[model samples]
Target: MRLLFLAVLRPHTGNAVTAQRVRAHLEAAGHVCVLKDAFDFESPSEIANLILAENFEAALALHLYRGGRLLQGHRIPFGVIFGGTDVNEDANQRDKNTVMGRVLEEARFAVAFTESMKEMAHAQWPHAKGKIYVQSQGIATTPNAAFNWNTFLQRSEINQSADNLHIFLLICGLRQVKDPLYLVDAFSEWHQEEPNVYLVIVGPEVDPVFTREVKAKVKRSPGVRLIGEMPQEDLHAVVKNCFVVVNSSVSEGMSAAILEAMDLEVPVLARNIPGNAAVVKHEVTGLLFSNPQVLVLSAKRQNDRIAYSCLGA
Candidate 1:
């Protein structure tokens, strides 16, 4: 079957990564999938024309508002996959929420990355409850064999030995929802006490204006390095070597980075939002922090555990 899959295809972002993976899976199963960025087209008619032009048999959308809404009014059947903002940020806005409700009504099925995410969506649009299925995000990490750790540290201007360095890698697109600067002040203070520790943020400049703001603040903030986006494999390589992976997003449907870190057997430090809480089992899968101070305390605890382990060895 020929399928049209719509998603926000921003470089290095989760939705783009997921959309590509889904398309790959469908194609591997002998289905033809056309992956398109929802941002490229402005209206439903454009997608309708594309569907007719390409003879797409069925459709799939990443976000209810961005992709699903555009697929509305089209004759072809489509399924909706909830993006992070769909149930978290978008649902709170009246205009987008109204559009999402109609999209859910028209959708044949819907997918949520976690049971909690499904519940959230169900709470907002109870009419689509039965169709919403929970499927955790899948991750595949390939750490670059030749990725130079010392080189990365040097570039970040982190003056510390590779063996003694404790780098917390926070991966997120520079956007308001990510709240990338949430721990900037706390981390900077922590760095004064532990000079070997650094907080490194790596991702695409998603929101240009906000990215500039982040840059300005990070400039004044010591022990925090903001690197530009890296290729998927390179990013995975960084995650593989980092002391801990961090997520400070204001909201999330499901974070692929957290899953990837867990898969790599790396420690995770995430904001104690409902989305993170659903996946992180407190002291089990990862540590959850309710605020910046708690997050700093958690990091210190983890570091102490590492120190004890080294002494034991």
Candidate 2:
């Protein structure tokens, strides 16, 4: 099979990871894949022309609207992979909903990262119910546990302490849907009570306005550390050392970061959104919280338990 995979690429992000995974899977199965970054094209017509030029047997798109539109316009047998914002947040808008609905209608198959996401697509577009498929996003190669922690801490400015310090890592590109500042006020209050607890926000500032807001909030809250995006391998190594991984996104398809933490055997603390709930089994794989207080308390308890268990071993 000759496949064409399309997505808006970033330096280090989940969408990039998804596109890479699909390409890998197809290639490993003895199929040829032509991967293209949709954002690189100046216009959608360029993307359409590229797809037509490749004579692709099948097309796979990451976002429902942009990627879907390009491929669908070419009358290709394409698949739609819903991104976090598309089904959860973007679908709420009238124009986006219509675009997504049309994409879903024309798609040969619609892939979602989680079961909940599949359900959302079904409910959103009942006409395309039978086409939805759920596949767990693959994690890239796991990090070897041989990295120099001392050097990493020095480079990242991460304080290495096991006594009373609790670090919660939230990794996501700064965007409105991520709601990076949701826990800022709560983190400040918690920091006052437990000076040792720290929240680290790590990811590239994809949106300048949102990134500026996040930076402004970080300035006011000393407990929050805003480390912009790090390399994928480096981020995985950091996840291994952290006490707990955290996510507070307003919407998600399936949190690749949370899944990466689970794959690395690091516990997770995530928001109670459907995507997060699908990954974190609540007290099993990780903890989920609807309120800020619950998130803080559950995160602390889970972090302590994980730490004690590690020490005992």
Candidate 3:
């Protein structure tokens, strides 16, 4: 079987990881797999021509609305994988909902990263109930050896000797749906009360306007560190060294960052939303907070009680 996998690749992000995983899986199983970064194309017609040329047995699209439309227009037998924003946020919009609805209708099968996402899919598109499938996104293979803590801290500008400093690492591309600025306001208050506690925002700034806003907020908040984006290896190393990993997205499918933190045995402090709640089992792997106050309070409590070395927090 010749399979064509399509997605917007961010070099080393979740969508890229998913695309690579699918391609590797299919190829390892004796199928021909080709990966196409849809975002690189100038037009949909070009994408259609490329897919037609591939003579693919089947196609797998990462985002429902974007990738589905391209494959569907080409009359391809394709499957749609829901991204965090697709079900949690985009489906709420009138125009995006219509586009996503059509994609769901045309897909041979639709995949959700978590069981909660599977339920959301059914609720959103009841007519396509039979086609929805729940698939856990597998974590990347762990590094061969333990990460160097001192090297990672030095590169990320983290001070290891600051016993009072409670570092919360938030990793996500700069986008409106990610609510990247949520931590800015929260960090301001936390910074005033607990001078040593700092919130670090990491990830690429994909959206210009949103990136500008995030930069502006970062300038105002001394405690909030917006480190733009780091390489995948560096990002993973930083996640392993942070006091706790944070996710405050307004929407998510199943955050790859949250899962990576869990896999690395790092404690996650995420927003109390469906996508995040599904991964970070509250009080077990990490704590989920709906608002800034709750997050700050929880972080303080966790910091006081739990030793970072105990569970690699």
TM-scores, in order shown? 0.95, 0.90, 0.88
Q: lDDT (CA) for every model shown?
A: 0.88, 0.79, 0.78
Look at candidate 1 and give me any clashing residue pairs: none
Candidate structures ordered by TM-score, highest first: 1, 2, 3
> After aligning candidate 1 to the native by TM-score, how far in Å is the CA of 181 from where it should be?
0.6
Tell me, by lDDT, which candidate is best: 1
Which TM-score value belongs to model 1? Answer: 0.95
In the range 1-313, model 2's lDDT, one tens digit per residue, is 8888888788666788788877888899999988888777666578677767877777888898767766656666788788877888888899989978987877899888888888888888999888888887877546756777678656655556635677778898898788889888898788777767878888998899888888998988867788878777778888888777889988887888887887777777789999889977766677778988888776556556764432232
Question: Which parts of model 2 have CA positions greater than 4 angstroms off?
Answer: 41-44, 144-146, 154-162, 300-303, 306-313
How far is 150's C-alpha from truth in model 1 (Å)? 0.9
Q: What would you estimate as the lDDT of candidate 1?
A: 0.88
Model 2 vs. true fold: TM: 0.90
> Model 1, poorest ten-residue lDDT window?
304-313
Question: What is every candidate's alpha-carbon RMSD to the true fold?
Answer: 2.5, 2.8, 2.9
Worst 10 residues of 2 by lDDT: 304-313
